[model samples]
Target: MRSRAIFLAGALVMVALLGGVTANSVAAATKTTVTWKLSSMTAGQNEWLSDLASTNSPGVKTWSKTGSCRFLPEGFKGFLSMGTGKSCTLTLKIAKSGKYPAKTATHTIIRAPSPATTTTVTWKISSLTAGQVKNLSDLAKTNSPGMKTWSKTGSCVLSPKSDPPKLTMGSTGSCTLTLEIAKTSKYSAKTSSKTMILALYGVGDTGPAGGTIFWVDMTRPEGSQYFEAACAGWSDRTCGFDLNEGSRDRLATWGCAGTPITGADGTAIGTGEQNTIDILNGCEDSALAKFADRLVLGGQSDWFVPSKDELSQVWVRREAISGMPGSDENYLSSSELSANLHIGMNVNCYSGCYIHIQKENNGYFRPIRSF
Candidate 1:
């Protein structure tokens, strides 16, 4: 009975020792608690965490080996995405004797600036760009907001070194005016204030007279009225009226009324007879002589019937008369001539003939007389 009791006591002691050992092992494992979180996800980095493990894990059975990853900090999980070739960091809050270690890894990605974009602006030809001429008139045509005023540097010559580049304006924003090249001259288009001419903006009353320096082009119904008689055939009495209505009228009136003085016998008035008839018929009929007997224009009595060269002068100097009264009609007259390529004549009239005034039309005349 004594031996049995002793053996039972020893067994009890052994059971107690084993239980304590098991308890110690469990406490050791639970003491090592770990807290982890992803810090950053750099560019080119994968959205998911590449590596995750408890720092306190032993080599034999690491946190990753168990596949029992714990929860991260409340707000950190949402910001952990990583792009390609980029990186993300993980922050660990480890207890000294707990389940995790304390450490952080940060990764950053690289980026570049975006490519440049192409932009364009409409710029008018200011001056003669290099080897070209600056043609304001031509440019104004066919362009929105036609070319406005030009700068002083703009040039008329085609070989460059003329005017600066410029643009016109209209209802729309800044716009470029198209250029029209002349068929005869190398000039892109006619430019220069030599001739005072301006565009007809809108219809208005026959503007104030004499003060206007420029001319406009307006076609009135009066032109077609006496077209036949005005376009006389053959005789110098009618002058060259067929070539063009306006031209015939101008030359006939100017040349006929502006012819040299003659004696009653139809002979040229040699040196000193008053030749008021020349001025009287200039650009109008005898009745409408504005400058007959030597009228004054620009303070001079030399204003005679423009010769053929003078007519061409009129063409080139068309601008000088722009914007003035009757300019629009004059331009229409030119258009009429251009359409037919007509050539009227201004001949010398020695024989006595009545200088007919364009019945209803008004004209300017300048007579010749020795002062």
Candidate 2:
């Protein structure tokens, strides 16, 4: 009985010892360890990991570990890698400041052959200056090619992860934007801004004739008069007329020189139509004059042929005018150079030069009204 009791006590002690050893072994196996340190950093700047103190536990193969590094609030790129081995001399660069309120980056380390065992180290990033923030914000607002408007929504920013930032337009409009010029070896940093305006049209002013106010007759008095196209069309010469005396007359002999004539009598809007009609009255077959006399548009019958200068204004503001004939075609002007020929302007060219065409030929016509 004594021997059996002694044996039972020994067995109980052994079991207790074995249980303690097993518990200790399990604790050690589940323990996580990582030996890397990082200090705060500024955006758009580069730094080396070796500058900070780092180490590995004794008998631990840190080089065989795989992990990734990333910044919070997203949009941070180029700071992560997955591989074995401790990269003591690894380099890190943060391109742009991330979204507001948070600027933390996390580095995750996982044990090789068993990713279940892992650890993480977090580091903070310094916020950008007010100027830098503003510059980056402006760069975000820059317009891209084929964009026609400006956008004010969304946080505008440049990512430092990308060496050169890209700009794009968010909406359509003609507006101004400021941009930041990054620092380079050749040039110091600076700010650049530009205003985009429609070529001939001002913002929101449709002209006096109730159409898009494309061009302002700078030479005319304020509200004195402006011209608008009655409609967009080509070749209304069902009835043609002689340009000069015969079928052809030199501009030198015709009384229509020094054109773009405004006022009454063939020069002004209404007078110009009358003047062409009077000159071509006897011909009865005059093409341009007859076309102008029979024209009507915009619920009004006061439409007439524009003078050479007036036609030139249309050319100058063709982009803003909506329906001026294309540059590939030519249109007739009331200014006559000869009996058989009349002065015409190419709708595509804005220089206002005169081209002569036969009076009998059908050409483009965009009748005009004045107010």
C-alpha displacement of 249 in model 2, angstroms?
26
Which lDDT tens digits does candidate 2 get at residues 144-233? 222222222222333433334333322333334444444443334444444422123231245433444433342344432445654333
lDDT of 2 at 51: 33
Q: What number of backbone clashes does candidate 1 have, counting pairs of residues 3 or more apart or in separate chains?
A: 64
Name the candidate that leads on lDDT. Answer: 2
RMSD of each: 26.6, 24.3
Report how far off residue 133 is in candidate 2 (Å): 31
* Local error of candidate 2 at residue 339 (angstroms): 1.9
TM-score for candidate 2, residues paired by index: 0.33
Cα-based TM-score, every candidate: 0.18, 0.33
- Residue runs of model 2 more than 4 Å from their true location after superposition: 1-224, 233-271, 280-282, 350-352
| Candidate 1 lDDT tens digits, 206-302 | 2122111111232222221110111111112222233333332222222232232232111121111212333242323333233222434324333
